[model samples]
Target: MLKKNLLAIALLLCISSVFGQEMRNCGTMEVDARLLTEDPGYALNQAQIEEFTQTYKSSETGATRTVITIPVVVHIVYNNASENISDAAVLSQIEILNEDFRKLNSDAGSVPALFSGVAADVEIEFCLASVDPDGNPTTGITRTSTSKTSFSTTDLMKYNTYGHAAWDRDSYLNMWSCDLSSGLLGYAQFPGGPAATDGVVIDYNYFGGPAYAASPFNLGRSATHEVGHWLNLRHIWGDASCGTDYVSDTPTHNTANYGCPNYPHYSTCSGSPVEMTMNYMDYTDDACMYMFSDGQKDRMQALFAPGGSRESLLSSEGCGGGVAPTCDVPGSTSTTGITETEATLNWGSVAGSVGYNVRGRQVGTATWTEGYTTGTSINFTGLIADTDYEWQVQTDCGGGDLSAYISSILFTTSGGAATCTDIQEPNSSTGTAGTISTGVTYNALIANSSDVDFYKFTTTSPNTKIRVTMTSLPADYDMQLLNQKGKKKGTSQNGGTSDESIVWNVNSSGTRYVYVYGYGGAYDVADCYELIVEVSNSSWRTDGSELLVERVLDNAIVNIFPNPASNTMQVNYFSVQETEITLNVYDLLGNQVQTLHSQVVQGENLIKVDVNTMAAGLYIVEISNGKSSYTEKFMVE
Candidate 1:
């Protein structure tokens, strides 16, 4: 080692003259300071990482190292054609990174003999991501046109409102190439920071193409330097005079060197050691700085330790291990153009799809009628009215790669002219829930093909057993039961126009809500379906079954008990859905009597009224919901 240092002194003696040039500067620290000031979470993240790295680097020695490949996505935010660099420029930058990190560059041998002993091959490689976050094939490049002439450390280019939002940071290393504001080569966010702005930003002019690269910074070392910061390597100068760069092997520098200063220019701190100006973390020109020290490599590798923030990157399938990834399945299916005989099925498009396999079958049947279409939609014909059917789609990715089918979507063809008007208005959400009386079979519309109905009904002691049943098929419908606290109690999703029902044996007696809606945007304007919220003191299995309860399916009245009652005589009456009803007693002369009961009901109901203040004569009971009326006779003797 003394001999190598003496050899370094010999190289130092060889260069006597020096010249001044524009010093290369990076904005990484400036951005880090800003984020630390503005975002508290970012500061905490940095603190935690710093603590871990401190302990890890000091305690761990000679640990086995493995080659870790990171997937990269280059985002091009440009204003003019000049800023929109070609694919070759981006690829060249990646090549430079591979060369520098893996010690595969042609200049590896050119490293000074003094520091060559501590130079490290970082065992890290980067590949352009093959699969995007959405599981679609990609070139690992994204180009966006922006109005801004140039971006600065403010990072306006990293957002969609200004330029383009970042891809998921956990999956890929994001690099933005743009015309930077005035004078800046590049900057990078450290390992621990917010995901939105987490990446390296490079000047479009210096983005590593030999044809367009400017002098001194042309060899693409700017990206290598910035990515080093991104991987948690401080500048070799530590941004201080003879400050610690956290790597023990590297020599402390007086300050940032410019124009590739001659070696052996010693800092006045501690050992007055010869500055390692050729290190990539130093401020040397691109062609001059080429090596990472063993300590620096260990520092960067610590970020991928068991509890590291970048650990998730180890599991990313973005490269698919050099194999072509599987095709993405179809998403979010919809049905339209419905009739008694046919309807249209549509879904989102899949990337690189050669065709889509569409399949449909009647509900409760196994046989599916499959068809093919190159477009995103297909027409289903020869259908039956009021029949329940389900369909699914799979993407044909070509090359014998087919994706699995998406979940089946349900629909029912309209046929019967069950024209009914909407009853409950403004009952769209829980906040505007309308009151529903138990045992009343309410008829309401899904109206305008997109209505969601919410209703609240109260239960009583021993009668807390609630069963909500939706009948008279209008479209694909679903029902859900919620407790007073808005927690889901039970849900019934029997797809298609088939009757949907949910039975809940609730123990408590409070207001429970019933949410009814057409599945998959299914609704009708002029058709109304029957919804019955039945409450009974009857027993239920709690394992998904219900016993019987007394409810008048058909409207009826009378069956007056006692024969000759005095006060508060039982006047049994039946009614369904929101309605008004009345009961009256008349003498033998047919004179009018007092009205017994008159109110609106939400579902099937049975009411008792008093006949006490009536004369000993015959009387009549009547019930009506304005749509229909029922009556019977008895004596108030």
Candidate 2:
């Protein structure tokens, strides 16, 4: 009995250590365990999946002869603006999935030569759903504003009350991208599970392209890993010591490996087999994990066989080509050469159409002004500055018949002014500087083409780590950290409207400067950005930790209950020290609707605000001490 207890304790320790690393932590096993305990029928379902796997492997004709395409729907639930990722990000994830599953990824050649022969194409494809379950045209992406700060495996985020609910699981692969608490990169549900909760959950930061993707997990491989689990592949280590992953091709691993390990990593398990750290099922960093083995591909294909758990998806018309009759809809529609007052819209030529008609309108307005173009593109000028406009293109097939207008694409015009008076100038070096410290966020803007904002910061002690993040922007911006001698220590220049961030752990204390500038000399007076510079002795945490910073109002505890309130809303907060607090609310259009000032004690306080008259929409609740401020989102219904 004593020996058995010791072994169990050791096993628990091993599992805990594996999860403690800064790597992908999938919760499928835990969710499955919970389901098995609550629903006895789930065991029978899992057993059926296993039986199908075995039978399919033994049958010669069971191998997938043709490619299988899976339809996908992405549900983005966000509390703040940044969490509501862009459509381009979601499309980038789909592109990554297709490349990796078909062995078309550029990194496929990086797979170690020893494992290259067994690297399977898997013959699988993924596409965003063009038609929703209601038989209506859709983009397959749903956005929901939630009061919940973070989601866990309880699947509360899967419901409409808390967030956007899943689509029909039998016909679509439901993917929820939100702020997952803890350091979890993502999680997945295996083939045999309740339909209501059948899907995958990915951390918003790890779901998309490199613009917002963090290091180590930024390659959009988290979804690839989670999807592998959803298709019935287990962890490379089998989640146990020397245990089988049920796939015969992969070598036995003692445990999950974190970061990028050196090649030929030999496991301590029996035979001292060299671990396949490059396998997608392993816990290595995204850039390190690349290929799937033949055995694992067979396992996924088994689920699509007749009478299998996911066989219904084979008949799903969600892939767009089969369900809808062939019509020349505009493709690759995009905008370029955008300025404060004009934009150039472009698209690929539609076959059968001689010319196209373009229409533009403000997003919330009803009227669209139409223009005709003989070529594939058109230019719209005389647009208002600092406003969002939606535009669409219709194919003119000839004889007065025009195809229906494609879905509207949105773009926001830049602020007209090239400069602002509020921001301090000439802070580009330590000599002319605005003082900054750790744990405080500063808001500023680049006023014009020549505008550059800089701040000089000092560390009180040695071996301090600092992280700088630039967000809430109006244009593409980049940042750099320089030492006292003007040598660049780090730089971040993410493209497009994505946020820029940089981290540096200095070994010695000294003066440093941060230089912020607009990309390609672009700047706007009306659009301000926030810079968060955090200095700590401890190592920097994951992106989730940075999100927590957005939650708190600088050392104050604030909570708003019953969000999406129909009547009165209660605001509760704790003042760490005596401070004057101001509360304000704003709408999506940046209009301030309500404001209140309060003198608070050092402890807890509650204030009720009447929101009955407010319209049903998203609102930002901002609480600020005299020195610092924080904001959260709440919905009024």
Candidate 3:
């Protein structure tokens, strides 16, 4: 079903007219005029023209070299059935936009001889938005799935759904691409009139179709025409009968004419002369059109003036000209911090950028230590812990001037030091022998022979996610998350021979339990194990939000007797709880698992919980109160 639509048909004579006939009026004309030039077309009277001229001349005299940047967000509304255009295609279109707007179209040489003389070098550039309206870095393109391929004036609302995902509009230009219902390939709504629909829409066939389709003479020209609308330029043929396109030089045409026509064609208007077939707003094939009259430039620049829609883009405050803090990484934030065991630097690159330099120093030091020609992100190791240090990054833009230095903001290294203040219990069993912070508990077991070990834990939250990493693995072995009574979660190969971890995402909430067992066979001597417990942070209540920290099961000593016990059970603690202890349980679905206990204690203690009345199933024993927690996988068989 992939086939060409009417956009590629032979030129037909179907009464070419303004797509928005009813919507055309003086208000629209005035807005378009105000965008390309300071003077509105309605104000062409001696008074308005003279005033605009004076202001413009004075502004020109004091103007400094400036480049106005507009962020862009592209929304690709496709059927989502075909090969989804890759992200690379989205970026390619952005590149084409920048190249075309700056008059750097790769096909400039291909312009027909009849139009070469009028080819206009529009002085502008575009960039993908570095910051979305929500203030996040985005490549600036979105995609939506739909069954319908053809869009019309009413379909314009789709651009909003596509663009609303952007962080902001005043800061970003939204462009939507889809199949159109008519001969129209693309159209821009121009900014201001309505916030509900404030963006441009282009037909997909005219967007990035191969080279010919991509030519400024083709797909490329659509962007030019739409941007003109974006910048407030009226069509050269105007909107109605003798509707002034506003530029005095463009010979008036009664309606849109297709293909190229010889000069000297007569018009009904007074001074009737040849038509301006080279104007971008004409319906002729892209190769037949060119130029934005000086009058048009005036109108375009007017939009960035005091009363224009894009005036905010012209302010000195809006310009970000300070040196970019250099980094070993291109997209990373630069800041001062402790000398890292591994230090990395990054920054943006221009074509031909050769190498980079890294400089660093201990905190408070006057001189910086330098490193030679390096690429992005350099790692430094063997540094003293608990010390402060700063680093700066610089890039060599080929043989041109060197980029400004980017420095790291102030930061320190502390957690690595043995004497750090945040250090709570160096030993996992410090506070309680068999308890973690809350709703999680851990018990170790030593194998008599060389076999796998089984463990259990519970949670209090409706659902749970249990991940286990070996605090310290036995010599050579492995483990897995096995099928329990509730549900099977996930399993992962441990980092080493005897270590493993798993994460389970579930919809069910409340106390739930989970179980774990070794991979190979039964228990074996010298096979020591340590256990850590965890609960998912998907809870609605914020008070216990921190209860969801990642934990690795460690240690292998104690045991719970009467496997699948009926009532009371013995929890042998290798050590004693000096203060408080917390415990909870959970199901495999990761729901709360369940809360087994919450209380303070002092010394070696063996506590028993009734299970004879408990339903038969798999559960997790989560033990924690405030500071920390432990986890174990158990079952009530």
Q: Give each model's whole-structure lDDT.
A: 0.72, 0.75, 0.47
**What's the TM-score of each model vs. the native?**
0.50, 0.49, 0.40
lDDT of 3 by residue, 1-637 (tens): 0011101101122332345321111122322332222212221232243244335634652344255666676777776544135566556666666666656766666554544554555556676655443333446776776555455543332432222222234555677777655455666655453333446666665665344343333445666677777776666665544545545446677666565556545566555656766566666656655555555655566556665566655532212332332222233544423343444444455344577667766443335678756465564445444445566666666555465555343344443422212112222221222223433334343332232344444455555545454444433334444333434444443322334444445444433223333432222233345455555565322223222222222222123434445565444322224444555555433455345553435422455666666665444455443444344445465
lDDT of 2 by residue, 249-368 (tens): 888888788789999899987778889999988888898988999888988988888887898999997767544424467899899998988999999998888798899886434357
Clashing pairs in 1: 439-603, 439-604, 440-603, 440-604, 441-603, 441-604
Count steric clashes of candidate 3: 116
For candidate 3, the lDDT comes to 0.47
lDDT, model 1, position 321: 55
Off by over 4 Å in 2: 1-21, 61-64, 321-637
Better of 2 and 3 by TM-score: 2
- How many clashes does each candidate structure show, in the order listed? 6, 0, 116
Give the true-structure RMSD of model 3: 24.9
The local distance difference test score of model 2 is 0.75
Model 1: weakest 10-residue lDDT segment is 2-11
Candidate 1 per-residue C-alpha lDDT over 518-569 given as tens digits, one digit per residue, 9 for 90 to 100: 7545666556789888776753332233322111223432234444455655
Q: Which portions of model 3 miss their true places by more than 4 Å?
A: 1-65, 82-88, 106-120, 147-149, 155-167, 212-217, 263-268, 314-637
Model 1 ranges with Cα > 4 A deviation: 1-20, 321-637
